[model samples]
Target: MVGGAILRKLEKRQAGGEDLTLVTRTSTELDLTDQTAVRSFMQSERPDQVILAAAKVGGIHANNSYPA
Candidate 1:
């Protein structure tokens, strides 16, 4: 939900002629837990900025069973 909101705001900025590029990927496309993959992606993209809005979501029961 939060990620969606941030993306929308960025999209609005881009539409308003902010002179920025927005690059995004789904969890299936890029797993944040893999250090090697992340490094490779960063090296290839070399983005001027990054926004990490990804997260692992769970319910109350799951949280209780496995706390992080």
Candidate 2:
């Protein structure tokens, strides 16, 4: 959700004439657990910036259920 907000901000900035390449992915598209693909994409794309938005959830139950 927070990443979505930031992406919106980037879109607005790009719409204002800035050059930006917005690369986003859900769990289905790019699972962080796959280190090989992640490394390959990172090396190939070479983005100017990176955002690691994965963080702790609200409670222990949420974390325990989705042990990524």
Highest lDDT, which number?
1
lDDT (Cα atoms) of all candidates against the true structure: 0.91, 0.83
TM-score of each: 0.81, 0.72
lDDT of 1 at 21: 88
What's the lDDT for candidate 1? 0.91
Cα lDDT tens digits, model 1, 1-68, are: 78999999999999999998898889899989999999999999999989898876687898898898
Clashes of 2: 0
Off by over 4 Å in 2: 55-68
lDDT of 2 by residue, 1-35 (tens): 67777888999999999988888878778878899
The predictions' CA RMSDs to the true structure, in order, are: 1.9, 3.9
| Candidate 1: residue 61 Cα off by (Å) | 6.3
Top-scoring candidate (TM-score) = 1
Clashing pairs in 1: none
